[model samples]
Target chain A: MYTDLVAALDIGGTKIAGALVDGHGRILVRAQRPTPARENGDTVMRAVEEVLAELTASPLWGRASGVGIGSAGPVDASAGTVSPVNVPGWRDFPLVARVRAAAGNLPVELIGDGVAITAAEHWQGAARGHDNALCMVVSTGVGGGLVLGGRLHPGPTGNAGHIGHISVDLDGDLCPCGSHGCVERIASGPNIARRALENGWRPGADGDTSAAAVAAAARAGDPVAVASFERAAQALAAGIAATATLVEIDIAVIGGGVGKAGDVLFEPLRKALSTYATLSFVRHLTVAPAQMGTDAGLVGAAAAALAKRTDAAAAGV
Target chain B: MYTDLVAALDIGGTKIAGALVDGHGRILVRAQRPTPARENGDTVMRAVEEVLAELTASPLWGRASGVGIGSAGPVDASAGTVSPVNVPGWRDFPLVARVRAAAGNLPVELIGDGVAITAAEHWQGAARGHDNALCMVVSTGVGGGLVLGGRLHPGPTGNAGHIGHISVDLDGDLCPCGSHGCVERIASGPNIARRALENGWRPGADGDTSAAAVAAAARAGDPVAVASFERAAQALAAGIAATATLVEIDIAVIGGGVGKAGDVLFEPLRKALSTYATLSFVRHLTVAPAQMGTDAGLVGAAAAALAKRTDAAAAGV
Candidate 1:
């Protein structure tokens, strides 16, 4: 089994990524193409096919036992379809069927990209060896997944651990998802920058008004910028504490652009967590920065494929 | 196995209730004793032993296979200890060992009272046959437990679903549990009655200031009383939505004293759920009243014992 491999795809609005990954999570071959996100569904799918063609052309392709796709969601793993918010051209797109066809009729597993990231972290990154954990990405959007009872809990629809959309402030600002005070509304990278600028923080000479710029200003002791990050941390802490209280997670791994704000974000988060996660079972919960890098999607896709393979074999499939 | 019974104990601050439950969840023998909650640890243990002795005196006790205890938590199932907040004298009490000895050394299983209710609900109540659900008791406190992937998720500590203490309002009133705006702080029966009284809703000539009194006043179109129940319903809805968002539970079964307030609570809760459970996967979540009655704890304890017995047999123990 160590000699065998799985073909993996990380499909997002910006790129179609393909790889042949070994059993130990090593990428033996890789291919990528920019997604034609604004075009029709068929056009975007062609880009995915081309990336798959490159992976299939590799000599290691023959050793691939299955294919796994981690896609921008809401993905219906049960229906083998995806309806990513950023990709308007592909609502209810039959991704698993198309990927299976492109990969020579091999078995295919589909999961939301956040769940994929969690799979990576649980297998080889910050959440490794922890039975109950949550791994999150706090970039343009906040997304996450859970590992429960020592296994990835993708739920019936493969979208269980969606912490960002969960309301922490029931009466706060209305979110685009039609919810009030969602964690993403307060803690995402764009929201952090927006809140900072709203409260009178100005960008540097470069005019770079991103969360990274806000992080730099916060480190420099800018009061308004510091306050913005503190608010985001507060919302994140509330959400994380809620998650721990609900499911008894021992650790929460945070990644993406805003998570890299270091102590500027973590300090206030730790303080706020103490205020919210007061339960006996949840008081010991810890927050850590995610260790998986940009390739987490591909690696996690491979892990999903491997798990599916094992499950099928156990069922005599 | 059908002829075998499990001895079940429902330990709380007010009472020590025991029963001999068969495989079909029918109680054949019963025993009860008032809890010596303020007495020393030995007195409380003695009360439990007396209850067990009563059950042992029944002729049916000869066919008992195991014993299960569902105690007010936080229960440490791994360590076989209980530290129920309402029962101070029994902090870290070795209930499992004591019960095992009292029950002729039969194998024992321990779970939190909330988890016990969830097992009963999943097995024979409103949440029956659901693969994933949350069962809650909203009486003096808002305790709850989860069923995930068709199995009771008691977590490692036997206290996975302590929903009462989860903060839904991050900056709201400080809770007695050292948290801010816990669900119990806002939605528990006492809190509901208190909020109504705080807002000038006077009790009747009967001087009954319970949540039930508020429910009656609200039913008679008292605006203040209606508003208080609405506020409690709002907090409960937020907590339930957060649970559904994090774990993908399709149904939330609510029981206990406050739950019996009927349309006064349920109407507002259903409306508020739409404001918080906004995600596609969570939008369809339903709230239903718990079907199991006062005996839920004993039956649920029996379910835990039966499950443990089956697991041990499967392991060839």
Candidate 2:
């Protein structure tokens, strides 16, 4: 089979997206459907099927050698299943098997959304050419993935870089994930907004209280808002430093809404990094903004699919 | 060149040890010397050379294919240099090149001591069958290494899993490494003893004030000593759990003096782990004592040499 393309799927709580991507990561056809997140598992699965149906109907589908899925985790690549926390209807859902069946028995590769984004970054964005890196998303929730020895390290369960859940403050606040002082609890967008509000940073006339609003306020010299962002930066710096110390990543690529805060996040992050990344090997680590846009998930899925196809070909599968 | 043995050197501040190791990880011949740690760099080099010379004089030296050194870090495997903190006399020393020349131009492999111990454990001890694990030493200072995908992850500079310096409490005590609230600052043997003494725990009739003595006091139900051990356990648990959460390790193998505290350490460690390792993938992580003893560094150095030799052979080098 001289297949030159792969089908990619990016499944999240809000949407099910599908695409036929070439070796160069160019999408030739696309499909998407709103996720019935609160509906039954079957309905959510049906939305995914509808998106896959559209992709299968495209002429580009003929060149797709395999199917790649980057889904909201926790995903079990070993079991080919996913049970994303936001999508309660899909507990231990057998996604890979269903996608494989829907794609005419094509081989399937699955990874967490964070891992998928890392794949995209490593393949074509900020992490490109870096042998070891950490790529993170700090929007509604903090999530991340890693590249080790120049390859994506999805780990045994496809969730290697769960930095958000790692405790940076052992005795701080409890996270919904059942851990205390998690990075997400301190650095995520919602948490940033919450902290700013708790510190008496009232919203503007429009009453916009998102982290973006906080960033604007910080830009306008609001001390309380600035302090909130600073705290979030400290937590993120601690987490990033911890990751580098553990695995020797030379760069951390930050993405998502909160990452878009620009200097409000990066300046404080760099300063705080010096406080935590003190080891000789880790002291030289750098942080950067992510380059890939919303299409990161699809492109990253394609990268993984291509890698899987190459591996299978090497094994003569 | 059908070599069946490799020469191994385990270099630290206190001692320099060498061995001729077989393919099965057995030490067939050995040599040792005290490190003149405070002397000039040449003196330290001389001690290492003496140990290597003894190994080279052994009858089994004829079968040695390469030389491997597991040295107190920070080691730069890429630069073939080392600058161990306790051995200040040898900064950026070209130990690998010297060892290679000393070993009759044989290939040389170098790794950090923590990584070396991890290799030993993964090859023959606590982490033997696990594909992913973290092996730690909580002695005078904390140190650790990782086994990922069933291989020792020595990382680019040969220092990957340096979990001791990771901050589990972002706003707590300042660490000598310049980081705040590092695991070593809270959980190391010296730190444990320091905390116990600072909290008003009196020394015994022998006036011993080591972490081992604190462990004994805790074992005998001394409240202050117990509290100190519990605190150390909490820090270790947070560090270990963070490692597991980030890298998906199924087990954490702890060694060194504090690890010998048995229930005094492991009991509270397991309890605190439940508080931090709350992610679905990390919830099942286990903790165990290292099976490899003082010779772990030697055996692990041998393991790296064997791996290097195998890679060379496979590449037709």
Candidate 3:
């Protein structure tokens, strides 16, 4: 059979999205379900099965040679399991095997959502032309992925770029990850909102205390909101510089809610980067907003699937 | 002639060493010269030429197909230039071209000294069996390199794993590299000695104020010295954990002066690593003393040369 398509599943705590993607990374069929995250593992599995059923129902599914999953992680690609912290019922869940069985035994490849996003960015977004780059999602949580030597570097466990948890301030506040002063602790959307509220940045008539609201206030010249975003930018810059120093990335592509803060986040981020990325090799590092939008995870997953198919074919498997 | 040997040059601030090494990593000829680092760039180039001349005098040199140079960096392997921090005479010096010319137009490859050590470690030392590892030199100024997916990851400019400059404390004291709270600023040999001295720890009878002296004091139950080493260990741990979190290294091989401090450094380092390496993928990351000794740089440079030759052969060049 001529297989020119691949199946992709982007599984998160709030949603289970499935799609059949063509060789050109276009989605020909799509399905999604609000995750029953609070339910038992089996119920969550059923939701995934339903999504797969919707995908399998499409005539395009016949062309899918393999399945690729981009799930909220820590994903153990080596072991084919997923233990997403937000998905309480899915600790060490055999996601790959279950998904493979549900999808008529198609070969399955799995990676962390951060790595998947990187694959998307490297394929057709901000990191497209860069051989070494970092792609980040700064929403309620800060997560990231790396591209080294022009390929996605999803380490052995598919979680090589968990930048959020790396400590930038060793003696700073203890993070929920059991680390002190993690980038996510200071730069995530929730953290940005929390810091702003703690520092007397009040919400308007809508009573919205989200980071977006804080960014709005910062845009309007609110000192407290601006300070909070600046602090977040500092942490993000330190983490980004640390990443660039360690792996020699030339660019960092930022996405997600906090990344949408535009100049408020990027200006301070670029300035703080100058403070940390002082080495000769890292001095040229640049930051840009991500181009991949809502369907990044799906497209990234499909990219992984296509890559696996190519690899298998190359190896004559 | 059947080419089975590689010529290696290990260039540092204090010395220039060269060798003709066989495919089995055994050195068949050796040469050395004290670096005229304070002299003009031409004089420094002459010293390197002198070392190469000595190696070329040996009959074993006839079998060498390529020459590898491992210099104190920042080296631009892509541009064939070097601007080592300690060697002020060389600023963007064309070391690769000069060495290639001096070595009878042999194919030449250049990498940082830290990367050379990592190649050595990955080829025959502590990181030999581990596919993903970080090898470091915690000496006067800390430096390091990485092995990813069982091969050396000498990023675009040959300085990927320069972990010493990565910030562990974003707001801490400034480093010579113009960064704040870099690992080298807190965990390097000089920093350890400086911190101990500033904390009112008096040198012993011999008045040795080096990090080795501080390690001796820490071993002898001096509280102040112990605290200094502990602080240095904390910084090293945070940096190591950060490296593991970013690139998924399974092991970190420590060497050089501070790494020789044994339990005084390792004990606190392991304790602090548990504090920062909280992610599942990085939690299993282990720290070990580097197995390659002073000869590491020479061997590692040879390893790079051999690798280059092998690659060329594979590509039918």
> What CA RMSD would you report for each candidate?
1.6, 1.5, 1.7
Q: Give all candidates' CA lDDT scores.
A: 0.91, 0.94, 0.94
Task: Mark the regions of model 2 whose C-alpha exceeds 4 Å error after superposition.
Answer: A1-3, B1-3
Name model 3 segments beyond 4 Å from true: A1-3, B1-3
Model 1 chain A weakest lDDT span, ten residues long: A1-10
Global fold similarity of model 3 (TM-score): 0.98
**Two-chain DockQ for each candidate model:** 0.78, 0.90, 0.88
lDDT of 3 by residue, B156-231 (tens): 9999899999999999998989989999999999999999999999998898999999999999999999999999
lDDT of 1 by residue, B57-150 (tens): 9999988999988999999898899998988987788888988988899999999999999999998899998999999999999999999998
- Could you tell me how far off, in angstroms, the CA of residue B166 lies in candidate 3 after the best superposition? 0.2
List, residue by residue over B1-317, the lDDT tens digit for candidate 2. 21379999999999999999998888899999999999999889989989999998988899898998999999999899999999999899999999998899999999999999998999889999999999999999899999999888999999999999999999999999999999999999999999999999999899999999999999999999999999999999999999988889999999999999999999999999999998778889999999999999999999999988887887899
Across residues A231-292, which tens digit of lDDT does each residue of candidate 3 receive? 99999999999999988999999999999999999999999999999988999999999999
Error of 3 at B245 (Å): 0.8
- What ordering of candidates by DockQ runs from best to worst? 2, 3, 1
Q: After superposition, how far is residue A2 of candidate 1 from its true place, in Å?
A: 8.0
Pull out the clashing pairs in model 1: none
Q: Write the per-residue lDDT of candidate 2 for residues A1-317, one digit (tens) a residue.
A: 12489999999999989999988888899999999999989889999999999999997788788999999999999999999988999999999998898999999999999999999999989999999999999999999999999889999999989989999999999899888899999999999999999989999999999999999999999999999999999999999999999999999999999999999999999999999999889999999999999999999998999998887887898
DockQ of 3: 0.88
